[model samples]
Structures are given as C-alpha cells and as structure tokens.
Target: MMSGRGTEAVADAVRRAFVNGMGEPVAVSTRRLSPAEADQLLPPGSEGLTVVVPEDDVLGALLPGITVTGAVVVADETGARLFFTSVPVGGQHELVAAGIRAATAELAAEVSRLRTEAAVVDALHSVGRQLTAQLDIDRIVQDATDAATKATGAAFGAFFYNLVDELGESYTLYTLSGVAREAFAGFPMPRNTDVFAPTFDGQGTVRSGDITADPRFGRNEPYHGMPAGHLPVRSYLAVSVVSPTSGDVLGGFFFGHPGTGRFTERHEYVAEGIAGYAAIALDNARLFDRERHLVGQLSRSMLPVVPEIPGLDIVTRYLPAATGSKIGGDWFDVIRLRSGGTAFVIGDVVGHGVTAATVMGQVRTAIRSYAQLELPPADLLREVSELAGALFDPSFVTCFYAVHEPDGHTLTYGNAGHLPAVLVRPDGAIEEIGEALSQPLGVGSKFAERQTVFEPGTDLLLYTDGLVESRTRDLTLGIRWLLSGLPALREAPDVGAACDELITGLTGGRHDDDIALIHVRHRAGT
Candidate 1:
C-alpha cells in the first residue's frame, strides 16, 4: 500500500512543479474546506493540491486510486468527505504563485467535464428505462422524441416512419416539444431530397449548422422549397433508426433549431443513441404483434369445429393461460361417433407453448384414430395413455372424455388424472361424475369408466382442471366451487350461454392455467 502511495507522491511532486512554486501547500475541499484546513492536509511548509472527490460519486476511469501525485491529485476523508492532494513547487516561486491560480482554474474545468459525462450517463439510463417500459409503439416513439429534444437542447423534435404503398411511399411524423402540430398538419411530407437525404435513406447521422446553405439543396418534386407554414429550421441533427436484427430502416429522428449553430457534435451523438433505442423498441413491438397473430391462427386451426348433432346442443370454449403469448395446450373436441353417439373430449397437456400444443395435437389425433374402433371409455383411455407414454415419456397430461348416447339416455365418462365433470340435473340437483380416476396420460395406469342416466334438459359439463383450480385453493374446494357455480349456469337458455357463464364465473378471464370446456345440454326428447 505504501509503495502505491509512493507513486502518487512522486506524481504529485511533478504536478506541483508545473502548477506553481508556492511558499506552502494549501488544502481545499470541493465542498466545505477552509483555508485554515490547509494546515491539516499538509505540514506548514508542504505544497500540493487537495481535491475532494465525494465518496458516493462515481468516477469512470479518471481516478483509479486515492493516492496520486503531480497535476492529478486524490486523497481520502471521513464519511461523505473525500479530498485529494496537489502541491506546487518551483525555483521561480514569486512568478509560480501567479501561475498556480491558472492551475486551479484548469482543475475546475476538468471537474466540470467529468460532471457533464456523469449526467449524460444518468440521462441515457433514464431514457432506456422509460422507452422499454411501455409496449405501445406510438407512445414509445413520442417519449423517445421528447427525450432526444430535451437532452440535445433542440427547439423541436420529430420522428418519421415511412410506409410504402402501391401509390408510392408515405411518411408518418410524430412531433413533439418545439413546433405546433398544426404547422405540419396542412403540409405534405417533405420528399427525400436536399439536406434530408442522408437521414431518410439511413446513410447515418447528419449534423448541420445551416441546412439551406448546403450544396445538396432541394431538388425533389412536390415542393421546391419549405412550405409556408413549416417551422423555421437552421441547425439540424438527424439520426436514422435502423433495426439491429433486420437492418431495415424503421424511421429517423429529426431535431431542428431556429438559431444557427445551436447544435453540436455532442447533440448528434445523443440523438443517435436515442434513434438506436427507438429502432429496438419498434422491432420488439412489431414482433410481439406478429407472434400474437400467429398464435391466434394456430389456436384456431388446432381446435376442431363442433359438429351438429341431432337431439343435443353442444358448445365448447378454450381459454389459454393469461401470460406470454397466451398460447397453451388446452383443447376440446365434439365428434359424432359411428354409433351416432356424440363424443365430448376436453384435455390439458402438462405445459405451455408450441411444444405443449404439438403434444396436444398428437394426442387428439390418436384419440380420433382409436374412436373408429368403437371402444368403450375405459378402453379408449387405456389405449390413449399407452400411446401418450410412448410419445411423451417424461411429460404427462390430464384429460376428461365422455360420450352421450341419446338412444340409451346414458352418459358414459372416463377421467385420466383430470378434474371430475359437473352434471346439472333438470330437477336442480348437481353431481360431479367420475371423481375417481387413474393416472394421467404417459403414466401407463389402468382406468375405469362410469355411467349415469340423464333426462332431457339436463346439462353435462366436461372441463380441464384450469377451470376449477386456483392459486389459493385445492382440488376439493375447487370442486365445491364448481358444484355451487353450476346452479347459476343452469338458468341459461342454451348450452352456449351456459358455457360462457361457466367460463366467466370460474376464470374471470384471469386464469394461471389454460382451460378447455365442453358443455352439452340434452334436448327434451328422451
């Protein structure tokens, strides 16, 4: 430690020589140091600079340690106070004293430079946070424009996005802070000519004191000069917003000042940073929208449309978990069996996303293939479970399958580690069918089917566990809630209305898991 301190001592010795030849060294705190405090920092005859770098202050690379020598000085203090030392020395002591004052002035300038850099860093961080926090593209663009205008001290700021059409290209301008929106409202977008060429074509950042005087002045059609109502522009800084991943020019940020020489190189740099962030934000938003569209298409394509069955009203609804892309492995099917019995199936796979969806598709296909064999509920579960175990060994899934036979007035149902189905009788009584079941698919467990007689107007509900399970309650309580909630559903006029009521009551549109529900109301015939 002393060795390092010794180096600082040597550097300080040289700095003092260049700073001044003083009678004695003085200690000065950037904050609260007095001339009398000079005695404490150094001996009476000692000469050096005492710079106070606050303990909490962050210095990038200017100072590596507290001990240094010569022009650059660093030292320590108790609690919040930190001071550095610098001593001035030379043979021309009388003349050196006058020069010492200039040394202090230079040090003050250096301190100001450091502070400016720190402020820029803090401002950039703030802009990044505010930009990514909102997903709305328009809002993000506006905020970025505002931040750039203020940070660069521009009179006005605007972000331009180009939209191509069969009729040629069009531009959308989002302006802020400086000029009134009405000024540009009546004027058509400026053509990519003259001074605006570099920004619109995404060449790079362009900084100019007086854009009108440039050699590559206006040369485009539609307008030869600035429109009557256009905001006066003398100084300008433009940065193109280019997507990092796609390399497509999304837009450009343009800042203008009415006074000449109002902008500098630093302003160009700040504007460029904002433009980069804006490009990223736009890409993220557009990607999310596209994904959501694809997810919606995939969801719609995967679930088979309910078939029309005589003497029965069937309705199905599938709601995915309310997170991410809201895509999960919840599905429902209504197939007319070979024997004219309507088979109702609703299942939930073990996970979410494309993988889970793919698994669900496979299982549904397997079930459909086996349905042709006319196997009973128990036999169907066994075959599907075996198939699932072979296909998805590590992961398992829950499913509820039931068949409604209008001829026998019976409902035969089976459960494979899935929630029990809710049966609402015409007499206002409720029952949970097949409460007991074997292991889920992929577990290779034996299964059993249960049968129940149903009268016309009776409602049978087959659902995935997402409807009856919640973050706060267990399976038993969820079952009880379902049992109680069915009465409200029974009053609905049709199966579709009843399904809607069940979903609205059970999930309230905020489920942590995907839900698949099948509701069938036996018409008054049997």
Candidate 2:
C-alpha cells in the first residue's frame, strides 16, 4: 500500500515489476489486494510506501508489504490506483524480485519433472502395446528419439550406437535422428572420419558451456561437426549412450546452441535421464531385430529342410504379417500321424509374441499326439481342446486339424473356431469345408465338436484372421473372395505356386496377418 499522495509515483514503479499483466487474465495470479483499502492491506510499518487521497482527491495513502514492492494503475477520484509490484532494498524490486524469480524456476522445474515422468510411463505403455506387435528397430528408434527430444526441448534428437557392417567391424555414429542423412543426404562416406576426439570415447557424458574454453577441443573430437573456431555453439552437454542391459556406452545424448543461458547442471541431469530411456529402448530394439532375423531364418529353416515325404508332394509357405513385425500366431504343420495317414494343422494363437508363438507350438504338439491315437475327428479336437485348456496361455488360440487317409482317399478334420479351409478338387471343383465350429482351443466351452470328411484330391487351406480381416472389411467378404478365386488355382499344378496365387488374389497382395499354407495331393494308390 502507498500513501494516496505518492500513489501515482509508486504505481509507476510497480508496473515494471510483477503485476505487469494484472488486467489481462494472469498467466499466474497472486493473492488479491485492494489498492483503495491500502491501510487495511498493509502490515504495521513506519512510512515505507504510503499515499492518501483526501476525500475524492489524491490525498494520502500508505502501503507496506514486502511481497508487493510497488504498483502502477490509473488514478481516480479515490486517492490513486495501483497495478504491478516492484523490487525492494538494493533496487526498486530486490527482495520481492528475487523471490519471484526463484519461485518461477522452481515451478518450471516441477512441471518439467512431472512431464518427464509422464513421458517415461507413456513410453512404457507403448512398449507393452508393441510387445505383441514385436515392433521393429526403425519405429522404436523414431519413437524413443521423439520422446527424448521433447523432454529436452531440443529442436530434434536421436539415439546412436555402434553397429557392425558386413565385414563385422564395429562402427560408431549418430543413428537415431535423421541428422546424419539430413546433414549429408547426398554426400559420400568420408574416407577417414575422425571428427570425434579421443577423450570423448570413455567420458559417459561431456557437456561444454563454452566449447572454445574446453581442452577436448585441442584433441579434435567430433563436437558438433565443425572447426572449433567456426563452431556456432556457445554451450553443449553430451552424455554417453549405452546398452541398458550390458552397461556398454554406445553413443551419447547431446544438447547445445548459441543461447547465453546455455544449459545448467540440472539440464545435464535431465538430458542424462532422457538418454537412459532412449538407451534401453534402443538396445531392446536391437535385440528384437536380431531375434526377428533369426525367426525368419528358423521359420524357413526346417520347413522343407528334412526333404519332402517320399510319396507326398508337400508345399508349405508361411507369409508373416506385413506390419514390419514377425510376432504372429499363424502356424502350419504336416506331420506323419502314428496312424498310417498324415495329419495337417493350421492354427492361430489368440494373440502374438513369444507367448502366442509358444501357445501355437503347444497346440501343434497336442494336436499331433491326439491325431496319432487314430481317434475320431471330433475326439481328436476334444482332446486338443482339453490340453489347450490345461495349458491355456491366457491368450486363446484357434485351429483346424485335418488327418488325410490317402489309402481311403478321404480327409477327416475338425474346426476349433478356426477359419474355414478352402478345398479345391481335382476336377477344378471347390468346397469350403468344416462349417461347424466349437469354442476356440483355449477359451469358452471345454471342447469343440466333431470333424467332417473331404473327398480325395481336394485342396485344403487354413489361415489366420490377419489374412482376411481388412481395415474396412469383415471375414465374410474374405471367404467369398477365396471361394471366387478357386478357379485361378485349379490349373496351377505346383502346390506352392497355387498357394502363392490364391493368397495374392484373396489378400489383394497385402497381408496384415500371418499366413500359413499346407497343400498335399492324394496319390492314385495309397
């Protein structure tokens, strides 16, 4: 509060301080104070800031609140008006001003921390969502980079580590952000790259407020990809990027620019935190990529590797999901059941990932065991269902189990809520068999119903939902498409070729799901 007489002068000083945005809805608001009731609002004091408006004129008024040093407002019939708050002691706004700054920094830090925590949690959820999707390296890299950059408030950022080329020599570089490409999109690789200095190798994180002042500059480390004297950087912070699981420093996370304030120790800590998440995500992505490559190799490894059955012309093709991921449920197997006949099964686990694939493997084994017993189709299905229930992998699965008797020239089978298989006969005729479906292998009812028989020389096919469940379409159209596409597959003698054509036509050349096909022709004599 100020004396009404000095209200005008005091108010002017306040305007330059805190209450600068008083009339405008505050970006931040303080406790309310009434300028007219200055005396009531002010604490007991001598005559620090006082003013008094005599009657309707600018008479007298006094204000003493360290929290609000001064004010600025339009003077009226009542004493004078007030607006902002000024400093104190050393300056017009010393004590109060310092307090305001400190409060602001603290608040900003708190908000930033909360946001960082949220980013990490959100990233964790993202990982859960992708566990089944088996997200690839590029996507994980981009996502992790984006989150880190956002947390650090950088223009852009990324994760970089060491990777081996064909020759197996480990090469290190910035690999996350599109920085390297954007910086040198058309340029060829440098013959001898040594921009990065030797000291930077083991120093987990190296930040320079003023690079010119740092001794590392003399060593010629790749700090910002430029000559030390010409570098447009005033400050920098770099942290070592590491393999989260192995604790091996891979690359680093860096923040810099020409800003005067530059980054502080707190900023370095924040950057390091950002790097921690990026490192873990990136490392996992690397491992996942390796695993997928192995899956691809293994998936094709033993399929026909054991040499086809002596009398059967068997062709198997496993088309993985087109989503750039391989964690899928679709599976196919051709086994020699203990009974004279051969059994074929196409199944899809309820979900994907190590879990779904594991479940599929289990179902495959159980189905094989039941088929070997030479029991009725329905009984085999029921046995499989019971086993699935016993080993129910939380994620349910669906399957089509078929045992072919070439001797009798008939195929007996049952459907456990799996997609109906297409059967193309020798005379270019086709039949979609096994219409009846019981509960899926691992869910709902305890067991599925019985099996049906398909005439000899009839082609049978089974696949996962990802095959026909399009973004805007249902399985009805998918089945119809398969039914209509049978004509084209009729003349294709090679089972593999025929399957390739059928899949391409029915799926419009894009398969969002995993497709597993098994084809066997009945011999003239069994």
Please report, in order, the local distance difference test score of every candidate based on alpha carbons. 0.71, 0.58
Go through the candidates in order and give the clash count of each.
Answer: 19, 46
In Å, residue 47's CA in model 1 sits off its true spot by 21
lDDT of 1 at 397: 80
Summarize candidate 2's per-residue lDDT along 176-233 as a digit string, tens digits: 4424445434433322223233213645566666765666454433433554343255
lDDT of 1: 0.71
TM-score of each: 0.74, 0.56
Model 1 poorest ten-residue lDDT run: 72-81
Q: Alpha-carbon error at 457 in model 1, in Å?
A: 2.5
Query: Which regions of candidate 1 deviate over 4 angstroms?
Result: 1-101, 129-136, 162-184, 212-221, 319-322, 427-430, 465-513, 524-526
Query: Residue 356 error for model 2, in Å?
Result: 5.7
- TM-score, cand. 1 vs. native: 0.74
